[model samples]
Target: MTDQTRISVGLQFGTQPPLNTLRAFLLGARAMTLDSVMVIDHFQNVFPTSIWDRDLTWLAAQRDTPHEFFDYQVLAGYLASRVGRMRLGVGVTEAIRRHPVLIAQAMMTLSHLTARAPILGIGAGERMNLDPYGFDAAEPVSRLEEALQIIHLCFSTQGPIDFCGRHFQLHSAPMDLKPARGRVPEIWVAAHGPRMLSLAGRWGDGWYPATVVSPREYAEKLAAVRAAAVAAGRNPAAITPALHRFMVVAPSEREARAMLDTKVVRAFALMAPPSLWRQAGVDHPFGERFNPLVDFVPGRYDRETMNAAIAAVPSAVVAEGPLLWGSRNQVVARLRAFGEAGLRHVVLAPVSGLVSPRAALYSLWATGRIARSLRRTSPGDGTSAPLLC
Candidate 1:
């Protein structure tokens, strides 16, 4: 593929930064002239809510914490109304938490408010979000598949929607609200595994994967999506290949590395299982001895214990993981590798000492630099090229 392949770069609003801080961050991002902005969907904090109830010390420590989460749909709508140019989206909303019909309606509302079709990113479900809310987490893939059908129907068809599925049933469900100018918002499916990849290719307009993926693995998964699209009689090139990456950028490599080697980053690295690391061609130091992916449940452990566990993770492992951390040129080279791997879009989540504004601004600056470089070198191949926006 030529540089005519347009790469859409955006920022992912993490699970921290209260509404005011978030709004300021968005303003700063807009000033930097980014392409799009995405917020995450979570009913509670990204951390396990059980932690507050189970650990008094953690609760006490949080008495003055500014780490708060806003509903992504609401945030998206608000941002759409305020931000003049940038596209707005939710990183990934679960089908289990909200019915697909409602999800469609929400997207329609956002589209109308923004005067442009927004992207609707969907995923199966996460146990952390589901189990705590008393929702059944079993058979998530099947439920998500059914939900996708319902959502597609709602967006494509007019009048009453009627559907019957294992997890959901709708009888003449009236979904009259349409997207702006009849432009249906793109449904970007967040998928990683084989089945989800197939689902994304078959039904979704885009494939949105997490930051844990390696460049090689991303190419492999993108190929799977393409093959599935071909098998489904759809154009493989039509589906957008997108990634959500955690990024830390600073003027100096030492500063960036210092920000990256923290408890939160370590915990995030440990959350991925060894099998996943091996799949990405990294040899995880702690194999079965520490399986946070399978064993660590949020709210089950105290903050002290969790910190201890995160501290035990080898710094080398965190350094070698999926995170993008370095000076501007280093980050650009890493991102270019993903671009060569056929990634058409990137959503970055800036990580720092509890979502510090200084770190966020540095990241936005770095991202702007990357976006400019991509656009400048982009060849005129008679195809739409990436825009900085």
Candidate 2:
């Protein structure tokens, strides 16, 4: 398959201190056929104090604090020096913290550093990143729409920008910076809901959803994105369909299932909102509308609170759609299914690595093998090549 038709797989990881582990992982990854490397941007981590301590003990040992998220842009610039021709991007950054102008400037600067065009993953503000710093988090989606417009204007407009919107007002704001060698950064929107999906088609060059869903459900979401793009008079196929999900791999499906039952793995279910827990006949300790991804404040919950929430997470979630895990062949088959659903790009990270040091090594090895198999096969095609394992 040609570049445009071939499947693209990327990695998403944090760039905190003790870069040796991450750099080692990337050194091994350099031999793989990865298309991109994405770093997450967040002022605060989602995990509470106790859960973080128990899971990421290595990081905890190195730092005074359990949660330490280095600035993504600074780390991305550093990473550019370490990586090869792979694309670089923040997996998803809030449009609220930094003004659109600043984000545009940062992207432009990084564009000169990387071999390929960089990506700017924009998403509506999350509470942990917003409410703590006292930034205005009200009407986040609406704010993000205005931010997208201003960012576009900053990159596309030749002269100063003069625009007014409900959230921001720019009076001839001068942003005359040009792209490095005409390589404009692509904006991939991390959209989930209907309105956010519409915004993605209207402004985004790619659609990136982190939620784990069946291939049919993914196709449905992609259809909505395409429909919205067509309504906006844009070429629907030009928008890349991407997914970001967590994984846990083992030699067999049963082993993978057992790995999923660990305390670290089960805690991931807390990332889902309470509304989802209710579907499984479980009550969220935080209440019906509580969503940790959106509303969780780091260092807020004690051990008991976290344990209560983790206990409330039914076994069904571990054996369910969101967290992808299985044997190598099963994982390849699942990814092939997603490819058939119009998934051109995917970013997966191993959640089971949090279990132990041995599990971490296996996770890296298995993930590398998975990346190789996908790159060799013609995904989205009816047939798949033999599993690499």
Q: Highest TM-score: which candidate? A: 2
> In model 1, what are the clashing residue pairs, if there are any?
none
Candidate 2's residue-wise lDDT over 238-294, tens digit each?
Answer: 999998878888877778878877777777777765445666786666777776667
RMSD of each: 5.3, 3.2
Model 2 off-target regions past 4 Å?
1-6, 55-64, 273-275, 378-389
Q: Per-residue alpha-carbon lDDT of model 1 for 1-389, expressed as tens digits?
A: 35555566887775454567678778876876777788888655435433333222223253343225677777777788876688788888888888888898899888888855688998876665677678777888889899989888877788898998899999998888778885578889988778999999999899998744467878999999999989999999999888887776778777877765655556667665465556555444444554543234475566666566666666655676666777766666666677888888888776642445476567767777766655555533222422110
- Cα lDDT over the full model 2: 0.78
TM-score for each model: 0.86, 0.92
For candidate 1, the TM-score is 0.86
Please give the distance, in angstroms, between residue 141's alpha carbon in candidate 1 and its true position after superposition. Answer: 0.6
